[model samples]
Target: MSGGILEGDRNMGLIRAQLRRQRVLAGMNQDEFGKRTNYSASTVSAVETGTRAMDTPFAARADEVLETGGLFVSLLELARRDGQPRWFRPWLDAERAADQLRCYQPTLVPGLLQTEAYARAVIRCDDKLTDAQVEQRLAARMDRQSILNKDEPPQFVVVLDEIVIRRVDEAFHQALADQVHRLIELAERPNISIHIVPADIAIHVSLTGPFILAKTADGGWVGNLENQLGGIVVDKDDALATLLSRWETVRNEALSRRQSTELMKEVVKSWT
Candidate 1:
């Protein structure tokens, strides 16, 4: 383990090494350390090996279990910005303050609707991403879902191209099934409405890409446009108008809420 700290003490490698040292000095193996921290042995091993990022709760638990005097917590605080890309961070605020959120996904499940296992599989598809990077993004996605679980959640409206459900992760089939099942469950919530655009459509505006718009608590709106590299926050008047127009076009093609729920149920059968 490197003793010298990175400039901001933000390097994840430091977190990994420090955790390993604390475990060893405490005379605990991964399983024992995990038990004390309420995590699995595999999770401990992953963090130590730089395969999984250390989240705040785990860091706080480690401080208690390892008696590090909150050192681990401090380190994670400095490195917290790495949890999500800078470009996408602004959107998270918009999501949390939203009165209503509308989204269109042509390729896969929306982040708010993903299960942990399913989120992992989708995130790992990026060959260039390290396991640690994958876990960081996955954690951010999971955290983003909390907005929906709030006491007064935003009304979340999602429109998916039929292929989103039809395309399943073969290697993680069961997780994919669980994800579809989750969508069905979420559809039952009063504040959530999910619609699916059938596959037979020849050509539609949704084929262009995916975008999300949130009507904030202040009665203003913000939109997001994502692509291969990163995403842009859409707030300019003309841009938002264009984006809203596009969303309406794609949403118009979707099956009604009742029909969509039945469609999702039918899709789950294929997965089984």
Candidate 2:
């Protein structure tokens, strides 16, 4: 096999091992495990054999049915962070394994869809990272985009605060415009849904920060919170529920897809 395909197989192997070990410990067979995860026996076998990738929804179901202590869920985070930026591993891992990725960003576009130029500008502005570190971080961010192309890629749902469109600085205006245009193009894909949360909307749960809600292959749900220094992964059921409720409200408040695309086009035009 070619190098890229080989690497994918190896990565899937790690996840398969993680699941197989836990399932055996729990004393369950493929069919029993499949039933719990809402997958067919063949699908489970394929996942175990590295022929397929498990997304968050299935991961969460597997976790619940196997009664594992977030093993399947944690592996996804680990995989994302592997051989890349250390600080971002937790969130990245969750992103790769997510069956459904729901994001609420008040200040900018989510990382997955960010264009290279826009990502570079954002990284450069970070006073904390050295120049080389910024470049490295940018590369890592770009690499994360591959998750959107994996077999059975996770469903991505993102909400952008309208202010993000208006907040570009003079220094990065051109790059930001390119980024917005890139976003509009990417949003046209079937797997991605982009929503704009109007600036005028009433306050909601995610106002204080950005967060991601991801499900594991075993039916486990995890909520991720990030800041300038570090991030926390929330696994407690109550916390996940609260985050989900907040996300639902935000989703409700955001503009529809058609409206968002039209708004995006208008924003991009202003830069030209």
Candidate 3:
């Protein structure tokens, strides 16, 4: 086997060992641990033995029950990093460590802000992914949201195209409503802001694409461009500058925070 495969197996083994050890230290048998985490004993066993991959929800619940102080969450991230394309890992690292995040989404709702149902619906659109793969991806996406709950969460500013709110399907009405409510709740946090760019805006730099610019603790910036195929981490000075320029232009086209909130409320009302 190739080195990459070998490394992945090793990392997975570490996760399995860590999870079993933590459970034992907590003095809980597999059945007891499963009960605490709201998973079946067989499912817990599968994860412990590496027959199944750990999902974000399971990791979070395990961390809480085991009092591991986020250890399981860290392991879950490492496992996810191992599975992702190499080009995406640096962006993931930047996202976890950044002091500030600026994002523009012209398509669907941003992954960080999506509700579970909305996320499931979005992931289901990909015909290539199997049910298990979809579940794993959903768990990882949900886990990333934990960053917002951290004591010193990053300052987040997100700009969404107005069409994103209006594009929801009738089947997702309730889920979309919950998602909009979630956006409203998150926007209320002093460190987070959400803006909506009017659909009528005839011109904007974000027309180029959706991107995120993260400001790291060491006063450096990293950018990411994401699309259907995959994601690219941007670190080159010229590229970063362009992304920042586009972000500013898009933010200028978006409504103010209060206006965006009111608009979102109006949209939520229409979901019924």
Candidate 4:
């Protein structure tokens, strides 16, 4: 296996050992621990055996039940951190402190805007993950949305290719409809804006791939390119400038907020 995959497995093994030790320290059997975490005994056993990945919710609940004072939560974060590519870590850090975020997606809906079911569907596309691992990742993704709820949330703007809305599968039709409505609701927030790039757009810089530009609280700018394998943080001044220019060009090609909302409404109706 690849080094990255091996590292992830090692981290998960450590997490499982820690979880099992903590449960023992609490004088709880698998069934008892399962009761606290709202999971079945078999599920708890699976996590302890490293056959299932432990999710954020499970960590929080376990920490509370075992009175570990967030130890499990920390371990869960560690496992997640280990699983991510090194290059993507900086972008995750920058996102938390960003004063403004601008993103352009040509394929899937941006993670921050996805609903729970939608997020689960996206994560499940990774066939390597066990059902438990998928749930773990899904919970983590959902937790990231808390950033949007901050009192002084970042000003966020997303420009999505029109195909993103039109490419719904039948199984997720209702969920996707809810997601469109969610976009509309989020757009009503003063700090958020959502735009759509018409499918017939003659040309655009965003055709290259999905990218995010974040303006940090201290005024520094960070650019990130996300791909299937991993992510890259573009920090060089020359590269940042080029990405910013492309962002402006793509933003210009996107429909206005009102028009995008109208189009979203139309799409939602078709899903019915």
Candidate No. with top TM-score: 4
Which portions of model 1 miss their true places by more than 4 Å?
1-35, 40-49, 63-80, 169-172
Q: How far is candidate 3 from the true structure (C-alpha RMSD, Å)?
A: 3.7
Superposed by TM-score, candidate 3 places the C-alpha of residue 258 at a distance from the truth, in angstroms, of 0.1
Best-to-worst TM-score order: 4, 3, 1, 2
What digit string (tens of lDDT, one per residue) describes model 1 on residues 1-272? 01112221347777778888888999999999898888999998878876667777889999999888999888875554444566666787788889999999998899999999988988887876656567766765776787898999999999998887777556767887888899999999999999999888768976888999999877888999889877898889999998888988888999999999999999888655
lDDT of 2 by residue, 54-138 (tens): 6556677887888766777666545434534344456667777888888889998788889988888877776755454454456
Candidate 2 — what's its lDDT? 0.77
Each prediction's Cα lDDT score? 0.82, 0.77, 0.84, 0.85
The ten-residue window of minimal lDDT in model 4 covers: 1-10
Clashes within 3 Å, all models in order:
0, 21, 0, 0
Writing each residue's lDDT as its tens digit, candidate 4 over 31-106 gives 9989888999999998888666677778889888988899888877766666665776688788888989999999
Q: Candidate 4 regions off by >4 Å?
A: 126-136
Which ranges of candidate 2 are over 4 A from the true structure? 1-88
Error of 2 at 135 (Å): 1.4
